[model samples]
Target: MAALSLALTALLAGAPGAGADEPADAAARGPRLYVPDPNPDALRQVVDLVKAGQYRDAAGVAAMVATPQAVWFGDQTPAQVEKLTRDVVKDADRSDATPVFALYNIPGRDCSNYSAGGAANTAEYRAWIDAVARGIGSRDAMVVLEPDALALLPADCGQDDAEGTRTAARYVEVNYAVDTLEPLRGTRVYLDTGHPGWHAVSSIVPRLIKGGVGRASGFYTNASNYQTDDANSWYGKLISSCIAYVEGGGDAADCPSQSVPRAEAQAWLDAHVHVPPSRMAHFVTDSSRNGQGPWTPPAGKYTDPQDWCNPPDRGLGARPTLRTGDPLQDARLWIKTPGESDGLCLRGTEGPEDPERGYLDPKAGDWFPQQALELVRYANPPVL
Candidate 1:
């Protein structure tokens, strides 16, 4: 409560409004995030570890879950989603913390891959977004809208009609969500760009503009993927600057990308992107599993390595915070639930086991004890 009071004071000193444009320093120095109640499954894991005489590990798991992370909503009816959203926002309000919501129910989400599941079509999806907006009515909340929605479209997944109808609808769905949610008094919406490692600056900026980045607060990177803070932040800066440049009548094709040398990219920004930090699209990065950074499998290990799919020996990144001194950046968040399996990673082999790990990884979103312990043990800054 005392810390909460100090954070509120700091936010007051900055700008008024949650997710609204405040002074750069005030937003950077804003209050610590509202930590949600621990997941019941996570609590049970801690208890199980205690019974096993693994007190230190139990404490680590407990500490990890206690830290702030996103509250995800997906695959629910409009009524159910509204209530669920309301419940979370109210709970966070009691703690004087701004809740970060990951809205993941966009149509054709994950491209029918391991994590595939979403609304049936654009109409239903828009209704869901409206319900979410209602659920979050008048509460300060941040939305990392639809991970991979912009980065992986139906066209990219070969699910598009001949005219790319589904792909065009994908853009419509995302834009509807942004228009619906961003107008709420206290909601800030950030569209996804997959991760720094996946998309180049020029490629993703166009997707963002088409998907309604112009009307939204900003964008986020490295959701549910491991790219080091240095990498994620640099990638974020490039994309933000590139988007600003394109929005200012410059060509996205002319925008610098990660493929260019770092010195060259910085030089390009210096030459063209003249917008101040406040005018540019701000961003957040996922630090949930980047403490150990990304994993590198053996060379030519498999035809489809799926390196993003639960590669071993990863650890947690920095704790979630709003006071990240970088003005163009907003916060570093745990967008993915750490310790959850990415899915069964066969690594292109016809087997049930994850070849690299020598076991069948749990289904995506399932509690994974082995991975959970590994994360706590290897967590950067030490989980405990």
Candidate 2:
């Protein structure tokens, strides 16, 4: 645990910090993940804490914001997105860092859930992707394309038409993004699988392939959820192996589910799923807020216990980096900024106050000060 803390502290010191530098090889060329300006609200939190004479807490907030996290782009015009993307890549270039750009504007995104907003149709999405790609032309950047595009499809959440028209378009939009962005000289595009806990290996591999994981770098799991690093890694390995099997003409349905005991799953992979690391899909996992693992709501307390929502007591997970030990695991990223809320979590209740937390959680993407403190305090590998 102390070693892990040391590594996290190094990462906080700088991307690919001591003992975590990216290989010099061309395939893994990102020098370090870029650290952009901190979110304004986060900056405010630090200032407020200091003014209130909480110097130690203020430093903790400052430290948390200094770590690298992905910059999300969605709901922007083609002209706007292109400029924004160009500016970010240019900034990272100036800093000699490779920024991770998370694209989130897919049609019918998030199944109209809390983080609900997207392009109105496939054409707009395609255009937006093109602008982003153009902006990233020949620049060094990693693209976590469309967080829930493949994970929470329209059909999966019953938001599709009777003929699954919207769902079909969703696939087209995602495939278009993959096709458009993955071809860039410096961008590595990853598809989505929501998280390890949400989709079975069998269920998500097919979705990944259909969404064009084969053409891109690989897929990402646990985008904004609190699944542990071990669980996410195991899930990624299984998913990547399944994709390889299917690419080699094996059925995805034959892949082992995460529920299968680990020993058995490894045996299954050894016996059947064989593709060299370079030949197979490689994955990244979100370690933004998995430190304390997941929040376990008081059992049977709320009817709709939205466990994924802003559950208190969660902590920041592993620091973002380009070097993960596993060859097939490309990166462990802070895909979700640690101190932000996941929306007003009603948790199946009547009043505005969340019964679970006894307070109204901030709206999605808002800076959550209380949760921020909890994240730093309970952080398994402490954020401070």
Candidate 3:
């Protein structure tokens, strides 16, 4: 523990002090996770409410979004990215916190969906990644690399990579990133392993392997989705078990799945695999909008569920923390940056607005006021 503290101190060198009134013993507790300066739009809403004498409401929203969160780096120029990265690391160091960064610029990101747009080609992506790495330098940073890079491949989305060239390039891009970023001494890289609701343990294990999970720190689940912590943890364990099984010369097809009964699955692991916790890959889950678990659309309400996208009444999940007790679980993170929109979700309806909400939603990555308030109001653990 002392060694870890010292490493953290080294990483936070040149960082500013937390505050003049901070307790002297605070440093003994190690670094807190850095929350990037709040979004301007959210802050403006707070200001507007305060001006209108809506103190309680303003306070509630402030409390919900003011906590430590990630800084996303996507589609910016190399120089812009470098400056932003260094600035964040410097700020976190000053505040005695550890910074988390999300890298989302793959060649064919999101398969031209709502959040579509990436580098023009593989070579450009490599250069962009190189710039990010240089900006990070030797700082102690945690990176959630390229969300959906693996789960939504070009081939699977009916992209014109018929010869598998684009799909092949996607793998190469992720592998290159793992190779480049994993070597940094104080850096930990986690590949995206889509949410448990989308990919079965057996299915994603192979994709994770192909995308270089073996070389990465581990994988992350439920980014920008609303799956409960219990469900996400169970799903992660199954994936880790499957990976260990395959690495030990067992077939991935034989692994227990999330659909299996819990006791039955545990029984299979107990009877078949002897691998210990340390042998399995560690994972993190997005707890930002899962406080109430997943939303259940009125039965048969729509032709397609689209449950993961901007569902109504979802609350905030677990608070951001590094002290998750499970040995194989590293942390519970707000990887989705709550209050950001999941695109104008049509949910398979023939209209410009969401059928459930009866209104148009914000575009992807835009600040969402109504949804943001709902997250705070229904927050399972309570925002306060």
Candidate 4:
């Protein structure tokens, strides 16, 4: 089949009412975002921490350091989630904040891999999507439809779990999300477009297209992963250009000068690399743990350099928030949601797991109070 990335470019470019002259005020208001990664488990911890009066300790820190609004689901059940989503959307509308959504749970998602496991199958995935859509109500909210769901699919992870027909099932699931969510009165749903380091523009665009980007609001470039806002903007622009090109009738098969070869593509990408603040349109980013990027283990010890495997000394990225200055940019989002574990933590994941830290203690998605302390450390002190 044509590469998944190409399909993404085409699919994502075809959202309903795109390029439809949004009001200037909309830009001024920017996209409303729900952040710090939207997992139910992590959000619950945040609530617990907040209730304990550790506002500076957890989600309270997120609220203080990032955007005031936090997205919450009513419950995991379809009926409850549906009601909760609408209520949250209404709350966002009333409070003048954006309701961000993770919309997790796709069958075989994470393919029983790290952050491993989710919904039983496609039908269940669809139900969850429907509930999320219903929850959106008729208010303006920004939804990060699904994280890593499209970007880190079967092929990307080396798992033949969803190849061919199964992959097609994923496409169906994603398209369902786009069709169901984007139509919400004032909602703009952005599909996950992994980070700049993970997939080439040509490769990822098709994946977005196939996953039904054409029907959603737009495809977001970086979510939860760190690659600097500067990097995110340039990457988003390049990818956006590719999608726009395809939507205008460009063939997905054509390499477009950049993707002809890996070396050439890398060179082209390098020259174009920059995180200008201008490119954040329908795109959103995860500012949670990116205050510092992927933690790199000291070289030579671990055989491999996949810092994304979970590294030490890595602090939070830009604080998760729903505000940003760029008119074209949607919102500076906390897509990853701070305090959630990145993976089953390790003292750096290679070899024997560290006993003191255990298998999942230091994972990226965990709620680390020390990490929050680091975030506050780096930023200019509060004026008050």
Candidate 5:
């Protein structure tokens, strides 16, 4: 999972270019979805669709698309990185869209795996952050600051690394990212909080707090993992509520309970699902390939749940965007680029390539070319 950190560079594919400013009130502006552009073919396809007046279709595709790119470990020179960002932003400007930014290069990125790469050290990482923040070029943006960096800190998969210094370093790195990007004109940065399925409310809340969730727009869930919208919503709400309760002087353990019967939980979740866009501020979702929702393994599939490893028949989920009905919920985004390999399942490395037969192509970022082409054909036949 740490391998995901390598995507920071790929994720920063866009900075600023053009777009109408959102209304002062985000709600009045309606639900604004973001589409990150890294793959040119996919970007052009969506742009063409939007240009053709297919807003809903475009939303369906771009809403939860993730363009989080490779940064820390790869050999992305300044010029190359800038070009990628410019290209993505250029396309976004033409499409009148804002790309969701996923900043995942925390110090111990991927814990020394193939994706285990960064700016040589903390100081270098900070400088890289500065360039990344600047590359955003003062444009309209929604950012997810570091994926598993916080979730997997001292507790999760992270190494204690040097008498616990690594743990402290992670915090500093996150704060720096928040501090750097928060001041940008219209950027909203959400720190990482492992999906509800991954961490208990108490467990995540503390980590988020340390990771600067309080200062950030909010914390994010379900990056590169398969959690249903219902699940994600409840997880996010519970975490948000827990944060609110703790901040308001409630006991950490007494925040709330989501372990009632499934029916009861769903009922409670339904009643509280729409917290209004204002309350949420802004949250993002990975609509890359969750349409059919998460994948479930058949009998005798594997020893461990195959959720982490790629499964089958999963379609793209809700589109990613800033518009959420619940006042508390901010933006819904595709922080995880779809189609990008979720790492070689066995080796734990996510490549930028796509698989021919699967939920989404691992190579094409998040654009489902096959699916998109089908829509294009349905909407407009070849002009013979």
Candidate 6:
């Protein structure tokens, strides 16, 4: 008990409202996004680069790999998940820092794409979520639940049952996760909202409502995508406003989208809603690779843009932090681990090699040495 108290003290010491006026047991006031275990492949790359006397390259890689970022939990059994979660929390407890977890095991996750694979069914998914909750047990952690779960539904991807069984199952699965995880005293749950580039405000607001956004801490954007921070903040604000409108007896269909002029959208919100920032939902963004603000394929180049796939020359964006000045924008995070691969992108080519780079790309979650070096070299704030 004494040790835990000391740990909590250390964790809260630098937090806002932790002065003499506040109670020692008060919850930390600001963003507390957790940084999980670093990817081993990234570490190995660092070592290899250093051994080859690539000192500048080694420093750049180290700048990214050494930072604290969210840990991902996906495609693991219940027992394996429980142990991993416990280990992360245990480490956070020792270090006096919060932990962030990306939970990605919804049934039919990723729309059967390159990162395809999830729990076999809703039952299996619930058991997996249950195990994750048990592992968390009341620890202070941020949970980014199920990337692409709502955005790339089974129906949207042509993977759904003709009778809508799979679509219905998807909603149930997300709501089940919200119901299960949100009740934990110290856990903050955020639903995935694709990104600014993909879903419009009018479209995703209803999905978030049906998927239990009200019960969650907030929704996250740009999870494993490369959209700029300005775009993401705009998208998130519009979504939060739309949610407020819907909660106050307005229709989501009436809300403006990213397509609308910024002034017009704000004017529409101003005319219709009176919700305060404190009352509305908050959001986080994955600024992992938005430094260059998304890749644009050469015009008339390919049938499919595949922009989200590993684009060449993308850079790291803002570093991870909870102290974002905007009240509605909670934090800018490295939700998509930098230096990780986004699958072998063919980019409308016939061969296995990527036409954009003239090389065979790494599979999802694998390390790409060339891309890793690019990220470090072009990091937005500069890795060095």
- Identify the candidate with maximal TM-score: 2
Best by lDDT: 1
- TM-score of every prediction relative to native: 0.92, 0.92, 0.91, 0.72, 0.69, 0.91
lDDT of 4 by residue, 1-384 (tens): 234334323322331111112233666545434322234443444455545655434433433333322353322778878877777766666656666777667766666666655566779878887878777767777777767778877655566553366667777888888888888788788887888777877888888878777677676766656567766765665666566556656654443333245466556535543333333225666655565655556656545445554444445444434445544456566555544445653433453564233443455445554444454334222201
If both were scored by lDDT, which would come out higher, candidate 1 or candidate 2? 1
Off by over 4 Å in 4: 1-75, 161-163, 251-281, 304-306, 317-328, 347-366, 378-384
Candidate RMSDs in Å, in order, are 6.5, 5.3, 7.2, 11.7, 9.6, 6.7
User: Candidate 2 — which pairs collide?
Assistant: 195-222, 343-364
Residue 250, candidate 5: C-alpha displacement in angstroms: 3.2
Regarding TM-score, does 2 or 3 come out ahead?
2
Question: How does each model score on lDDT?
Answer: 0.85, 0.84, 0.82, 0.58, 0.57, 0.83
How well is each residue in 80-160 modelled by candidate 3, as lDDT tens digits? 898899888888888767787989999778888888888999999999888889988888888999999999888888884
Local error of candidate 6 at residue 344 (angstroms) = 1.2
Better of 1 and 5 by TM-score: 1
lDDT value for model 3: 0.82
Error of 4 at 31 (Å): 7.5
Error of 3 at 80 (Å): 1.2
Off by over 4 Å in 2: 1-30
lDDT of model 5 at position 167: 84
Clashing pairs in 3: 15-93, 15-94, 16-94, 35-69, 291-316, 291-317
Which 10-residue window of candidate 3 scores lowest in summed lDDT?
13-22
